[model samples]
Target: MTKTRRAARTAHTSARTHRVLLAAQLGNSVGDGAFYVTSALYFSRVVGLSAAQIGAGLAVAWGIGSIAGVPLGHLADRRGPRRSAVLLALATSVAVASFLLIRSFVPFLLAAAVYATAQSGLAAARQALLAGLVEPGARVGTLARLQATLNAGLAVGAALGGLALSSGTRTAYFAVFALDALGFLVCALLLRGLPALPGTPAVPGEGPRLVVLRDRPYAVLTLLNALLLLRLPLLSLVLPLWIVGRTAAPGWTASALFVLNTGAVMLFQVRAARSVTGLPEATRVVGRSGLLMLASCAVFALTAAGLGPWPTVAFLVLGAVLQVVAEMWHSAGSWQIGLALAPADRIGQYQGFYGTGVPVARTLGPLLVTTLLIGWGVAGWLVLGGIFLAAGLATGPAVRWAERARSRAAAPVAGEPVKAY
Candidate 1:
């Protein structure tokens, strides 16, 4: 084939691949959004579980599930990401279906644990698959596009879930769960078409790969990333409580803030990620995200000053905007750095390790935000902002240290310096 023709063909194939992958992501995210909105309600009203039971069951289940990521990711690395992803998706579907039979706390906890483990496994495998599918340079941009698509799907699914909430019927809940399972099935089928790319084979004399855990710099990076993810609960849980108790804004303002955040993410996430093409740029983006988050916290704190209703609402909206902007940049920077720092052969394990931050943040963020940000009021906000600023400033140095660690690992014992592997 002519050079121009070959280039055109390759570009077309790449575009087609991206489209299919994005469609699968959108489908899965839509179901996840609906499930997220309705799961607690389903367990509470439909299953007739007490609030305390549901909370305890879910907490224990999630805690157990959080530990599954590393081993499952290692499994993906040892086998193949494509096959592992498909299996995990199927497992997730089964877990979601199991929710239909849940009655008492024991059954509920079991279903939740299964669901969480499958979800975590699926995430690790999917990320590994993406790494194998796309070129390194394009990974962040593709991830940003997928993130935007996910938000868009979630917005639509949240609306559907709201309809279910309004219906307040067991059938409505069942329908959402069923749809979630169907989405996972569809995602699995879509992934089935992807090419296989297994983990790198072990070297002759190399010991078993436990590198991710032993790498202190990477572990520190994961911890900081977890801290950055505190944005999740701050927006979802803390802000609404603050608005209702401390500010004059109406209850509906909380829904409006959510809509604003979702809309902003859908519209701006990809665009915001465009500049974060390299490690240095990604680190800078993370720092900038922290500054934005700090500004958001400050804006949020202003709403607590007994501002009038409309004024308080305006500030709340502004804070949501800033927070979502921070989210976009943080996500972009984190995706780039996480993928770039991981060894190609062990990307699955590293991704799984990095992903542990999500559960960590989800598990601990509520307590931290509720205790510090909400309990202490304005001082809490400043402290939280300071935390963001410090974490952001530290990201660049942390990344450099990780690079140096990699260099040291790659160096020969004969005092010969080697290029970073």
Candidate 2:
């Protein structure tokens, strides 16, 4: 074949891979949004579970799932990110189906475990696969677009699930299972046609056995991220319950989330994408964003005084504002740091380690907020704000530590710049 023809084929293939990836993400996130909107309510009201039980179970499930990312990441590296992602997607679909089929606690817990493991493996593979498909500069934009799309999917899914809940049937839950399954099958088919990751030799057994642990910068950053992510529990558990129990606005809770998501995707995402490019150091920006998140929590705490609906809305809105900003900052900064800071030979492992930050938060946030909710009232929620802010600030040192480690690791060898490719 002529050179021009070969280049055209490569371009076409790359586009196909990107399309498949986006589809997989869309499906997964849609199902995720739908499930989250309805699942807790179902678990509490229908499944007859307590708030503490539900909270503890989810934290355990997510944390366990997150812990699976590193080792599974090694397996993905051994075979291929595409294939691993495919298997994980399929497993996730199965897990969701299983959970819906049986409403018992043991069964539900089992399903959560299965989904957790599948998602962890999928997370590592997908990140590595995306990096392989795109060039360095383009990767950032690709990730941003992917996030924006998922958020859009999230909105659609949440709306559909909310509507389904309003209908007072379990149909939406089952539908989510089916949708998740289809996403996996679609991703598997699309991935089969793409090229393997760039910069990797076809040879096997070339990387370190525990290569992820060697990535000191990513490891340190992971700790900071764990601390910062403590904010999620407030949104996931505390605020939802608070909105429902504290105020008389019956449907106001969902409406607030709906508004929050809308504002995030439409107004903030573009600005986040543009501003994060060519950043000096991930540590500095991450630290500052953490500080702002703290400020936002303080703003949210003020909502306690006003019994009026608009006050709650205003407080929640302010919190959402900081959250969107923080989400953008965290997403861009973490990916860049993981891909750029880690050794080229061990990107997948680094990604896994980096991904753990959120899981750790998942474990702690709900438990912390739930306990405090019983004891402290709105003050407890405000304390959560303090936690998020403090977590962010405390992470500054860890971030700087990671940056230094990455710099040392990237030091010139034989007087030439490091071969990141």
Candidate 3:
């Protein structure tokens, strides 16, 4: 074939791969959004579980699931990400489907644990696959596009879930779970068509392991990332309670904030990510994200005074907007840093280690936000803002430290001088 024809073929193939990956993300995200919106209701009404039981079960499940990521990620490295991802997706579907059979606490807990573990494994494998498929320069942009697609899909799924919620029937709940399972199954099928990309082969006499645990810099980075991810529970859990309890804003303000946040992400997430092509830029973005979040917290604190209804609502909305902006930048920065910093051969293991931040935040964020922020009132908001500032500002130096450590680790022990990438 001529050079021009070969180039065209390669471009076409790249586009096709992007499409398939995006489709898989969209399918799973929609399913997740739907399930998340209705899960509490389903467990409470249909499964006859107390609110405390559900919360405790989910917390334990996520904690266990988070721990499972490392080993599962190692498995992806050994067996190949494509196979691991597909199998994990299948397992996730089965676990979700099992929710329908939950008659008591034990069954529910078991099902949740299985589902969380499978979901975490699927995430690590898929991220590893994505790293292999997309060129290094385009990985962040591709991730941004996927994030946008996910937000759009979630918006649609949330609407469907709202319909089921309105119906408030056991059959409706069952149907939602069935639909969620189907979505995962469909995603797995789509993934199956992609070319298989295996993980890095283990080197001879390399001690049979690449110990992520020993990487202090990486561990510190993960901890910082987890702090940033506290935004998740901040939005979903704390903000709602704060709005109703402290702010003079109308109750509808919470829903409006959700809409605003989701809409902003769908519209601008990709744009926000476009500038984050390298480590320096990514670090700057993270730093900026923290400032924005800090400003948002200050704005949120304003609502606690006698601001009246409309004024309080306006401040609330403004805070929400800032939070979303911060979210967009934080996500872009995190994706780029996580992917770029990982060793090529051990992408799955590293990505899994990096991803532990999400579960850590999810498990701890609600408690922290509620007890520290909500319980303390406005002062708590200021303190939380201070935390964001500290974490965000620390991220750049942390990344630099990590890069230096990586260089030292990669250096030859003999007379060869150290070389930096």
Candidate 4:
């Protein structure tokens, strides 16, 4: 075969793999959308759980799941990411299905914890699989495409879930859960088609099993990323509350903001990621994203200026646009740096550790952000914006420190002559 033809065939295979992954993502994401929309109602109406029970159960479940991720990810590294991912995906399906039978608070909490742990593990395993399959140069771009697909799937799933919400019937809620369960099942089946990857063996004399914990610089990066992830709750909790209580804008404006953010991410995330090709560039992009987030916060604060309904809506829209754009930029940069900095042999554990940031932000952000943005009002907005700005600005130094540490670790020991293979 000619060299060009071989290269073409390789490219075609890669494209096919990427498509499969996207399909799997869309499958589960649709289920996620339905669950997100209807789960609370399902628990309350169908299972007779109180609001406090639901809240406390989920918080504990996710918190425990977040801490479990690092160890589970390490297992993925030892067992092979593809196999780990497929098994965890199946586990996730089972856990989601278990919710159908759960009635009391204890059963609900156990099921939720199982579901959260499987989800965290599956995410790490899938990330490891992506790194193994795709070329280094294309990882971030491929991640961008995945993000877009995720949003698209979520939107479609949300619409379906909304139908279930409208019906408010037990059968309708059960259908949503079934669909979510089926989605994960499909995801596992699709993953089975990919080429197998062997697990990476630990290096001789490696100090510990979970090295990611001991890596101070990576921990700093993870912390900063978690801080930026405050944006998650800012959108889901803070903005919606702000629109209703503080601004003169109609309740519908909150929904509109969600649509705008989702649509923009689905359409523009890949484009936004185009420039973040390296660690240095990714760090710079994060810094810039922080600035955009800060600007959006300032704009959001202005909504309380007692502007009329239309004007307040306009301000809200503008702030949302800015915030979503920053979200795209930050996501792209974080993906690049997170994937790039980890040691190749331990990517799964590192990615899992890094991923805890999402749960951390999700678990804590609503309370913290609400206290600041809603409690103190405009000054709170300024403070929140400053937090983003500082986190962004701090990334560069953290990355540099990580890079230097990596270099030192890889350097040949003194008085040990470098040997050619």
Candidate 5:
């Protein structure tokens, strides 16, 4: 193809792909708003669960899907990512719809669990799909746009859902779930346009499920990813508790979170994408992203000292900016690392393996963060941030070691025994 025509095609694909992202993200934003807050609120206010019970339930509910990611990723690898996505999407919609029938706290949390799994499962498939669709050069930008879409869409969703929720959290919860369902449906429908799934080429006799693990560097990256993300669970769960316990926000306004996620994407993610793409390798990119994330955690934790709403909003906005900047670097870098490490034929499985981090963090970090976070307040977030800082700093050296090892392993030694033995 001519360069001009090729460029045109690339632009077209990006645009179409962005539409799919926008639609899916919008659905998630609305649904997430309802799911995280509405469902929990319903559990506490309506279902009569004590705070401890509610926390346990949510932790349990979120963790159910956390451990399931790798297997689901394996399933996505075998079943075809597109098919898995559609199945997950349809199931997600149904799962969300079932929220309408919640009778008690346990049942509601179960529905929440289904909702959580469906969302993450579909997300893993969707991301794997996108990694296949866009060219490597454009992937970071595409990821940024996708993140932006989620931020913007979720902003809208939170607004509408919050308003609807003020009247009754339960009724709005169902509506939010239904909307989330619609996003999954759009995602499922869009998969038809993608002609193939992204993966590493398969080797004979080796199942595709093991594709991501074949490379030691990739495995190390996954471990690093898990360690690096140790703070997200704390940020999501413990931060909220501190905010309410410490601050006197009028309505448990997590608007700061919304600002942190959405607004950050709007401004800095693209700039971050640009910087990451210019980096030498995915590993370096991830490390830098981690450092940026650590900074965000520090900035975010400052809110515990009690900023006026506007000042808090500023910190929140600053935190959001850093978050998406890191997100841009991390998402694109991680995608590239997984793709480079994975066999061309088994991208789905490799991606699934990469995705296993989510549920892992969701499951384990809560107990750790909660135990420590209760006494620390802002200091806890700072400590969490410091942990992220150390992880970030460790990444460059670890990845260098991984690369050097790969090179040495691939090198043929002059005196090494050959098959002649």
Candidate 6:
């Protein structure tokens, strides 16, 4: 084939793969939205679980899942990422279905653990699949597109879940759960349609079994990323509480802020990500995002000045706009830097280990953000701003350190010459 024809064929294939992945992401994200909305209610009202039980059980479940991710991702590396993703997606469907049969706390915990583990593994496997299919230059753009699709899917799913929430009937809750399970089934089928990637083989005496565990530089980056991810719980927990207890804004402003955040992400995330093409740019973007987040927190603090509802609403909206932009920048930068830093053969395990930061932030962020924003109030906001600024500033040094360490690791010992590709 001519070079032009070959390029055209490759572009066509990439587009097809991108479409399949987007469809699968939409399916799974819809299920995630429904579960996020309805799961707590189902546990308390439908399954006879106490609030304390639900909280503790879920924490333990997710903690287990976080630890399980590394090994499960290694399974993807040892087996094939596509096959592992398909299997894990099906397992998630089964675990979601098991929730329908649970009548007590123990069963709920078991089912939740299974679901969390499967979800974690599925994420790793899917990322590995993406890495294998997409070219290095195009991965971040594709990821941004997927992120936008995820936001759109979540909005649709949240709306469907809201209807179930409004009905407040057992059948409605069950329908939501059923829809969630079916969504995973659909995700698995969509993933199965994509081209398969074969397992990567290990070279003899290369390094430790799980190199990511011992990679100190990568660990530092992960920790820093986790700190940035504190924004996740800030949106879900702190902002709502701040609106209700600390600010003069109406309760509905909280919902409006959420819509604004998600909608902006859907519309502009890809554009935000377009400038981040490499590690240096990624670090720069993240650092700037930190400054933005600090400004956003400062804006949020102004709402408590008793400036009346209109001004308070204005401040809240402005804060949310800044916060969402910072979120998009941070997300875009992290995705690029994380993938850029990983070795091709171990992308699955590396991505899996990196992703542990999400659960870590989710677990610890609530306590940290609530303490700073809710308990401490204005001073707390300043402190939180400082924390984001510090983390963002630190990311550049961390990326450089990781790059140096990776280069050292790849360097040959005495008498060993490097081989050209």
Candidate lDDT (C-alpha), each: 0.86, 0.68, 0.89, 0.92, 0.65, 0.90
Better of 2 and 3 by TM-score: 3
Residue clash pairs of candidate 2: none
lDDT of 6 by residue, 245-356 (tens): 9878899998999999999999999999999989989999999999999999999999999999999999999999999999999999999888898878778888898898
Q: Residue-wise lDDT of candidate 1 within 213-255, one digit each (tens)? A: 7767888888889889888887678878987888999988888
Off by over 4 Å in 6: 411-421
Task: List TM-scores for all candidates, in order.
Answer: 0.95, 0.82, 0.96, 0.97, 0.78, 0.96
TM-score of 6: 0.96
lDDT of 6 at 303: 92
Count of backbone clashes, every candidate in sequence: 0, 0, 0, 0, 11, 0
Q: For model 6, state the Cα shift of residue 338 in Å.
A: 0.6
Residue-by-residue lDDT tens digits, candidate 5, 240-295: 67557765444345545645655766676666666555336666878777788879
Pitting candidate 2 against candidate 4, the one with the higher TM-score is 4
Q: lDDT score, residue 378, model 3? A: 92
> CA shift at 19, candidate 1, in angstroms?
1.0
Superposed Cα deviation of residue 151, candidate 5 (Å) = 1.2
Top candidate by lDDT = 4
TM accuracy, model 3: 0.96
Predict model 5's lDDT versus the native: 0.65
